[model samples]
Target chain A: MQADYVNPIFKAANDVFNSMLQLEVSRGDLETNDNLVSTKEANISIGVTGDLNGSILFSFPEDMVLDIVEGMSGMEMKEIDTFVTSAMGELANIICGNALTTLNENNYNCDIVPPQVLIGKGQTVAMSTEQVLTINLETDIGEFDLNISIS
Target chain B: MIWKERYKIGVEEVDRQHKELFNRLNDFLQVVRSEEDMEKKAAEIEKTLNFMGEYVVVHFDSEEEIQREYNYPDYEEHRQTHERFKQEIMEFKQEFEADKCNEELVMEFSGKLLTWLIHHVAGADQKIGEYVDNN
Candidate 1:
């Protein structure tokens, strides 16, 4: 994928974290993975269509997900249940929608569909793209992975 | 679900509506999360849901009018997102009508609404204020 596609997503995540969650996001080393897998407690996949066609997978560890949810809603959540997963899905949805808006400004004409959320530790997700660029994001509360796969 | 000061978008009317949304949603969520049985709370939940459904439409319309008055460049896009959420609310109403207003649906709806409203107000709606500030 082009840096044009990837940069906006990272910027969106950083901006959303800063403004909404009051958390600062730092980028970790970039990595590439062949298949999309969920190694965390909360995982979300949002599909990109229009000019860009693929999906973005976000994986958040259990502790981090709880903290993030707490920060967003001020609710004390203990488990990765329906409410938690839905919140995660909306979080990813906002990040992807914000990124696509940036792309639209550059005339990329891209759009993101609603997110599909999964909770668990081990599951392989089917994606439309072959080479996935995984961006590890660190927040004070915890860490999560943003896997970008677009053609 | 507390509404933080950071969620305000600087526009008085819009911010007021957003805060009202936050307040109502917080109350609705509180009732939903209570220890009361689902059947006992169904009437209250349905009433709050209906009120929220109507309030959201009014809020969106008012906000959109402000966007137009400011000639906000992203008015179309912002309106599109509003339409999407309105559709979701409509679906929720349908589910209620279909008598599927169970704990699962209520939980999912409340969760999605909490995050969606915050992000929309703080992120997308902020851009409109930023646009006005810069221009």
Candidate 2:
């Protein structure tokens, strides 16, 4: 996808992490994804419609998933259970919603469907054949990747 | 979960309702997560669920009223999100009333509620504050 479509997602991720999770995110390397499988333990996939027609995949490591749930709930989260996975999915949902809002400002006018949370590494997710751009993001808790395959 | 000062959207009534929503949800979560027997917690859980489902509607109405008052640019989009969440709450309430509510469903509901509130307040709701300030 063009930077015009991709940058909003990155910015929204950083903003949500900062404001909601009380953490700073440092952007890491960017690469292209040839495989449609997630390497991280928790994969949150959200569909986009309207101006964008593909899906957004947010893959988070197990530790980061636990960290995020614990941070938000103020309770100790030891494992990636339903509670943890659901929270992670909602996080992805919020990020995508905000990104679409930004895209609307640019006249892209997109909307996101409810997020689907997939647990376990190497999970295959449905995505478009369009070029998939993966951007690595680092936080004090852990690292994750944002995969954008929207056309 | 505790409501942080940062979650405020600069609108007094809306922020108050948000804090109340957090407090109520935190209580409901505590009941859901308690070590007590499931049968014993059933009545309390149902009561809280009813309160939450109704309170959310009232709060959304008030928030939407404010948005209309300020001519919030994203009023329709924002209201649509609220409608979706209200429908979710209704589904959960129906499940609970239908005797299908279990630990898994309760856990899932709590998790979604927690994350949804935080993000909506800190992200979407903040836009309302910004719009009012700018105008």
Candidate 3:
């Protein structure tokens, strides 16, 4: 993926974290992964279509997922249940949606499908292509990964 | 309690509606997460859903009107998002009416609502505030 494409995703993640979650996020070095795998317990995959075609995967650790839900709802959650998973999926959806807007401003008209959540360990996602860009996002609650593969 | 000062978009009317939405959603979530049995919660759930369904439409309309008045460039896109959310809520209402005692559905709905409200106000709607400030 081009730096142009990746920057929007980073900006979106930073903006969403700061505004919605009220948390500061600092990004680590970007790296490439051979295949898409759930490095964390909760994974949300969002499909992008139109100007760009492929999916973005957001992998969140179990503790981070619970922390985000707790932060958003002010209620304690101990497990990765349906409610937790749904909220995680929406978080990915929001990030992708904002990225699409940024892409549009740059003349890349695109739209995103609703987010799909996968929960479990050792689950793998079949990439549409060979390489995926991965970024580690460190937030006050915890850390999560953003895997991007779009042509 | 879900309403936060940080979520304000700087547009007075829109910010007011957002707070109302958060208040309504907070009430709905409390009942959904409560330990009360579904039978006992059904009436309150139905009432909250009704208020949410109607109030969302009102809020979206008022917010969209502000966008139009300011000649917001992304008005159509913003309106489309509101339309999609309204459809989802309508579907949920229909499902709830068909099965009034489904605690699982209520739980799912509450989770989705909480996430959607936060992102919409803080992410998408904030752009509108930026535009207003710049203009």
**Which numbered prediction scores highest in DockQ against the true structure?**
1
Could you give candidate 1's per-residue lDDT for residues A42-122 as a string of tens digits? 899898999899888898999988887777777788888778888888888888888988999988998788889877767
Across B45-96, the per-residue lDDT of candidate 3 in tens digits comes to: 8998788778999999999998999999999989999999999999998999
Clashing pairs in 3: none
CA error at residue B49 for candidate 2, angstroms: 1.4
Clashes of each: 0, 0, 0
lDDT of 1 by residue, B1-135 (tens): 578888887888888998898878877777776779888888888888788778899999999998898899899989999999999989887886677448888888888888888888877888987887777
lDDT of 2 at B40: 89
- Docking tier of model 3: it is medium
CAPRI-style class, candidate 1: medium
RMSD of each: 2.5, 2.8, 2.6
Residue-level lDDT tens digits of model 2 in A28-77: 99989786677688999899999788888889998888878877777778
Output the better candidate (1/3) by DockQ. Answer: 1
Interface RMSD list for the candidates: 1.4, 1.3, 1.3
How far out, in Å, is residue A150 in model 2?
A: 3.4
What Cα-based lDDT does every candidate model obtain?
0.84, 0.85, 0.86
**lDDT (Cα, tens digit) per residue for candidate 3, span A3-65:** 767889889888888888888889986899898877788999888889887888898999999
